[model samples]
Target: MKRLSLITIIILLPVIICAYTYTVKQDGTGDFTTIYDAFTCYDVQQNGGIIYVFPGVYENVPLFQVTPNSVNIQIIGTNKTTCIIDADYAFYGFEIYNVNSNLTIKNFTVQDASIAGFRINSGSYGNTIIENNNITNCGFQANASVQKSALICHGNALIKGNTFIDNYNNWDYWAHEEFSLGGAIYIDYHDASVTDGLIEITNNDFIGNFARDCGAIFATSNQVISISGNYFEGNGLLESTINNNVPQYCVIARFEDCNIVDFNSNICYNNESYEVQMGPSHEQQGLVFKDCTVAQIRNNTINQNLDLSATEGIKGIMINATNDEGAYNIINNIVFYNWDGINCMNDDYGSLNIDYNDIHNNPPAGGNNNYVNVTQGEHDILYYPDLDPLTFQPIWNSSTKSRCIDAGVPNLFDDDNTPSDIGAVCAIKHRIDVVDLPSPSVDNGLKWLSFPSLDDVYSTSSYDPDKAGDLLFDILFPFEDPELEYVKHENNYFVRQWQGNWQGTSNIFSKTNGYIFQMNEAATLEISGFKVSDNTHIKLDGNSYENWIGYWLEETQTLSDAFGDEWNTGNIYSIQHQDWSAYYSEGTWKYKTS
Candidate 1:
């Protein structure tokens, strides 16, 4: 045989060493049927490539393990909602241990694992991106001795646009044990070898998650971390039966030995425990820098986080720092409607600056003394900021507009104009446009709306044509019986009567403009061309409304104005669209729904 020339061998190598692309489809129509088959068949060690999974459920596979120094790979899905990797039998959905780098997992739903959805072990040190995935129902069957979470990141990672829901860890697998740590996400440094680790968690939704310590997220000993623009709702709290009494803090970032930690622009509401807890616990906060060198906590909206335990009530922000050299800045945030606002325990050495914040209405019974622990800056407002009921944005009024306008730091600017309002956004003036309403007409009336139950009931709003300031409205309906008695009041308003829970008649007053209605529960009412101003807010029972309509157009106009008396029960109605022309131009209001 004749020996091949150098030019002939070089040309053949280019065709042989090309990267491979594999498609894993559940329907046996692709290159591989299972994800494990794709990993085994592809030349991952030499030439790493993409494994695109089609839209279907892939179940009963191994832990989808990736070894150390493996080829850089991407496991992508056709759709985040449809493509599901259900590792219900395995300990974890994806166990990446000591991987080199450039591992990307995106756009899939990973659920029902015993330990965790994605477990990135300690030695994995690379640029990792975990985005647009739903990690749910994990960590429930984890071992008693292990600490588990839905997503555990021990490497430098960027986690964004993911939904973590209904993930729980067992309170105590053994009798009288303190075991579980995080429910949704846990970020920790395993050893000193992994230095300067950076993790950014942004724009994710954490809902209905549970654990012993932190329900949403727990971060410790990371060098640099930024958590921003995330929505955490209805998370935290141990089951009522568990006996563990440890202080369960939600969204904890205990950076006892770290540098540069920023928690900003996050919306944390309706959670079960403390909204945020940062810094050390035992030492004097002002004397020694316990955890973090520099910390910036700004522009976060924390509301309605109450203690799950009746015996132990919860507070809003708990910052315990002792570093004189480092600075802890809590500025431009809205800490409202909790048991307490900001409790800062700082030693003489630590520099704790609390300024330009709206801390009010916490523990409505307690006076101003329960608001702020530190001596706030001159611009900080203590009274109710009068946030919009629906959007939670600051309304254009005396209480909110007077003190918060132009109050933030010189560098930061509000959304509206030069004068920046406190909290997340600046005050923008506009009218209330009914963006959506429950469709099929029946699902609109007589529904139970509460935290974690009707939590997904959201109606969109915007500032538009009417220019009616910030519009807030209340929902009213009779319980048990559909028949309601109406009496016209003196000021062109009507007082409607209905049977109460205590075998007594309850009376509600209607507004003259035909939009606002008075009831026990404070709901974010949607009315076309309505403006929300001064009104008394009353907290009602969890199951309050029986026959709820969006708004009562004319109080004396009877059942027809209340979106019709006949409604189909047991069917869920979703909002289709709001007929703007019908309400604005014709004066006859009608909400079009499917």
Candidate 2:
């Protein structure tokens, strides 16, 4: 007992009462009187620590202009309902500029500002965590003469689990008014040039906002974003009067030099326009949806509540790939629709795969008039379990007896072998297919026939894992040719084929990382129980070769480290193109830098 007491005292000794901690109350008591007074009392020059705002209504004052490395300002509330930041006075409320990191503003009700409720002008790219805050009734002008955003961001921002109600869209007469100007959360890359910044907006509710232009959570230039698990109701341009410029969509991506927009596990319904839109303009001139891209638009229950007179359900056109059609621009989806569905240009040479969809009621399909018009240099092909007579609407309501049921090429769709089902499904406890590719050797350069995820079975990892972790992060090279049997963790197996010559079809490889493994080689290599994805950062081993391994990443491939150098997959290394740049010999993994 004595020893325990001494140890407890030692641990407690470092705990100071924290005398500098400034506390503010609404009734004008403690360290400061009013909330704004507390904000002002703490001189950015002297007091530098926690600034706690006790429960009360703080109306109409621009709280604090955070100075550099001044202090880690934390605006804490007794509870979510008690704390509030009212902009009943200032034109723009809570403008944060030129500050260090570690700025956390949580559980505050901030509303009624002339411009933006919360504006992040500029700050060090560190940690800005805004959580559980209710910011609403803020306004933004939609006219060509003025510019505003509800939660305007100029640098890297992270906004999560907050409710933004009735924000943006203050203009009623401007021909083009955007309700969710930044789509609730907006971002523009540094200097509007693709310099690789991170913007994550997740699990938020955005209702009754209007932005006449781009995404509800819009971002421009070079930025990588993840807009996931968000609920957008009555979101988009409100075409109240007829000036002919209603808002377009729930989400939009435009003129993005190099970026990624991932929309996953989200429920979007009843918007004025298409749910999501991506383009380099209507003509689809300069869109490149490749390497830095892969939208897992699966398991999304997209119901249409469009005004009918205004927009359709969902339409995605010009999915970029403008630079290297086959290599840089690839759009794959397993969309399961209830109302209207998706439509896109057909470009086979562009390497787009659309499989296992519950596509109903699409006019001008099958017969002599296909839904898509194939331009001269486009490669548009549809792979499915068809009657092969090119029968359109063959599986309609009464007569359509789930023909695509179990009769799909799953291998081609989920190259990752995530779900064994043909279309996108919600059931998590489902089986998955095996991933199989070709072989390579000293004779041939290198080739991977395909992921072989088609057959009804559980298999192994597609790529071999290095000594450190799983094989290639994004794609796991297959182990066996075809395990035809349903092995639960079969796809978890992998192996790295040693130096060798290989050959096969172009589609036998992945467009993600620029390296090409031996596909369809005469010899056989077997590996099992190997894991990949965010784990093993495997690349063609040595430095005998430069940029040229056995293959190249697709054009849109923006991976900095092809071998998983960075700890995580998304932010670090990336693989681009699909061409062989190196060959193997002398008992090792060689490369061709030239």
Candidate 3:
């Protein structure tokens, strides 16, 4: 008997699992009308499934708990801002009970809940992803104490790209001394140090949340906790005015006893009380063993916390981790306009490395501005960052450049292939084309393509391969056929056929030219490059019969804005998406359906 090759064996070893997807529409056109009834179906609840909710205001939503044996579920909204699941201050958000199945909730406005927005109870082993949501006014208690707020998570969870606003812990008038867990998110106290207990909270926004203790996040985890790329503003600024004695201990995040804390690229602005504190928890009653954190806190920008009238705005970052094993490196950050800059004074573990930071404007009578409790570091500087007040990016329009332009450590570099800046602000790319693959033709897998993001100036010379996934889209053995043929229309139809493992001519690829993709299967094409433009100015081929034009405009625009003065004069175009067209005749453009 002949044995199979390793590649063929590996490909055949995988099992193909079929998944069911249900759509919930408010207009009674989809598979289900209500979000609750969609999950309650026997086929969706017993087996794994996906539910897509359409754009509408869904009212009076109850607490949706993950039942036993219900696994691998996803509830996604059509639009992030429009599709709303309004709880009406009556019920809690979605909950995951003691199940080892994965659950994902994305792109919804989960608003006005009485308890946690997305609660993951203990005994959950699978991953829970809560992404791209607007969780507002959830997680509230009437007269109770020790209440956990929005996005209360346990086990492996990823909370990313969510905006949380005004999710209070308790609404009691006289509970000023009440012990609050977390205002926006409480990692429901670590559950016994399992190896698979990991949680990552990244690229989220926390604004105007309230707790008696921590006003934003109070995370207690034994897993590797990574909180990065988050924006925190006005946390602890909104509080109950009836009894306002309790101070917001940590305004942004209070991480307690994590295994590894990689806190990077966060921006905290004007939040009340201490911003981003990491220390051992006081809940263990001074018998903590696995609490000394190995932290890498770098490239963060903490600015202008509280007005100091509350007297709780103490430190920008108060890192109290007595490192038992690994080191704590605090580098390349800008801590400005605070009561105190940093208080990483505790060196009982003797592994505190603090350098290359800009700590300036500490409110005149600020607290510890030292690196080691007594003396300042030699690498720390007091310089004006010259940042934009709104976006927090470095000011680049003026002749005088910002001091944080190229001030980071020499080994590190920014995402723009330049020397890294000091603060959390990074440059956003000018043009990026993230388009899904167009629908495949019924007859063949051939598709029409146009490079909307390719720069004509950059493509004239050599191109950067790393700018996109690949500049030439990997001409090295990508085609299914040994000799694959592709055509592009420039002055004339130029068709080229190349064999496998041979790089084709790169000059035929241009944004001005349209091509036919000889693809074997459908796949997403990612293209990002550096090109500053208001709108694409296309110089159409005058000699050619027709021109293929493509422009990357995010929003809808008038036809005149795109083609300029030539829009209505004598131009004719066909929209491939809608299969509609408008042909110019006798100085008039008339629409026609195919």
Candidate 4:
């Protein structure tokens, strides 16, 4: 640690002491009432801390301007679904322009942003993170061609772990000099800085985003652009306009003039456009890269259910590399079920390396030029990727191991230390059909029961991490889940088994004891979160009706042995059979064996 001078310490003491955390709860319990007010507060603007938005709708709010040169600001929401920013078509959700301070926005459901959702224009906020948000339907529904997108970034920002859906622009404008672009996100960082990866877009899901150009994400950057581990499905339009020469086409992603591009491990499925055959070219597939110095497009799975009417061209990967020194390594990808596979354009300038790819089942697949290079080792394949029908993941064949399994480049190992799979690291996902409750029990008409969870519930990263093993009422039984007496919960005793009565008036939820709940007729409630694994000492009341015991230990033990230390003579009845239980009476322990 570097020692600071006395003068430096004196100068920094005031700023260090003034940091504040502002809470925005609509119920008048927090520091501020609205999100705008909490963010615009003097203390938050000057000396930044977290502006924690509790579970409630912050409706009709405008941009809370970010003051330059402030400390790191973090605006967080309690839950993505409950903590809503309903723009009501008034303004964009949030914006931070030309500030060096690291800003983080997480866990909010932003809806109906008339102009846009989240726009982070210029700045080297290298630590600027926007994650776990649901930004949906945020752009102009109908407008002339203009630069409107769900998220627009000019700086090197981290856009990760978010869901962007239906941020469309139904522009019918005639061809103009500038085209409306990037329905979901636009990384408009053009030669702003050569600093690599100020704009890292990874692990995001872009679904059903429509734009005249670059339906999902567009980046024209001199910096290193990395787009990995993302799911782009149902983006762009299936129907194309009957334009003779529009100079605008739809694509999941388009990167132009970037210094370096790293696009890997992305799933682009069923993103198609059946444009009429025209002299003007259109990209109707996963990605389009133009004029990038260096590009590594690897490990991507692009599968399109070829529309029979698709005429012009529907390619899996499209590239226009004109730079003579540019190096493009297009490898280890599974491109199938489309009209065409990989279309490398103007490659006389750039050195294009195509190898180790499973490109098959095109109207000519594999390589467009049989459609694939059927040669061995480093060359591409012209075979079928045996995939499960229900879930589009690749399947492992007992006889003749699947071509997709060990088809990737050698030495690049997977997480399990085996040779990597070809397509986007897919595993067969198990699906359980949705089961509906019987409105009320046909036998007794009782409703509420207990948590689907058995162990102690823990806090999530979106929620406060401080409440690690503590499950508060607001955390588990959120108010938005409808606490309408006896339905979501029976009554608010909170805990029944703990020896000491928890502060009923306070917000603390007893961790050691099991609880009871009463469902209304029968309603759907979803509760799935982290669980604490460490041993916790539980104080039991030992009263018959007071306990709802749980199997908390890792090893199985006899109920008599586990609770023999405490005075116990109670019946343990489960919902399966009200009378079937372990009971103790007349100095003998009885077990109702399953």
How many pairs of residues collide in model 3? 0
lDDT of each: 0.59, 0.44, 0.65, 0.64
Worst 10 residues of 2 by lDDT: 482-491
What TM-score would you give candidate 2 relative to the actual structure? Answer: 0.52
Candidate 3 per-residue lDDT, tens place, 464-577, comes to: 433221454553234454223354453343444544433444444566446665544445555544443556566765643566655555577755566777776564443332
Q: Compared with the true structure, what per-residue lDDT tens digits does model 1 show for residues 1-594?
A: 999777544344455664567899877899988877776553753466888989988873332335555466777898999999898657788776655657778899999887789887635456678889999998776345566789887778889899999998656533422446677887776466656678889999889887765667777754578888888777764532354334444433334455777888877776754322333331101011244677788887777665433322346676656545667888888877676677755553357788888787665555343444577666677767666766666665422333444556656765533444566655564332232222223343222211111101112244221222212212224344322222222223233443453211232222212222223332344432223322322222234232222332345664233333222221212222222212222333344433
lDDT (tens digit, per residue) of candidate 2 on 1-594: 455444444345565655256777866676876655655553632454566778888775444444444455566666667787788835556766554545666788887776677777553444466777887777554443434556776666678888877765444555445433553555555554436666677777777665654434556534556666666565554432444333544333332333556654454445444332443222111112333333334333333334443323333323433444342222222222212344343333335454434333221132221223422113222333222122211222222222333333444433334433233223222223343433334324344322211111222344222211222222323434321111111122123333331111112222222333433433333222212222233354333333322222447753334433442422322222234333334433344442
Per-residue error for 244 in candidate 3, Å, reads: 4.0
Model 1 C-alpha lDDT versus the unseen true structure: 0.59
Off by over 4 Å in 2: 1-21, 34-48, 60-66, 123-126, 140-145, 172-180, 192-196, 240-258, 273-301, 305-340, 345-594
Runs of candidate 3 exceeding 4 Å displacement: 1-18, 57-71, 122-124, 171-179, 237-243, 273-291, 308-312, 321-326, 345-347, 364-374, 427-594
Residue ranges of candidate 4 with Cα displaced over 4 Å: 1-20, 59-70, 175-177, 192-194, 238-247, 275-285, 308-313, 364-377, 389-392, 397-400, 426-594
RMSD value for candidate 2: 17.3
TM-score of each: 0.61, 0.52, 0.62, 0.63
lDDT of candidate model 2 versus the reference: 0.44
Judged by TM-score, which candidate is best? 4
Instruction: Report the backbone clash tally of model 2.
Output: 79
Task: Give the per-residue Cα lDDT of candidate 2 at 56.
Answer: 84
* lDDT leaderboard ranking: 3, 4, 1, 2
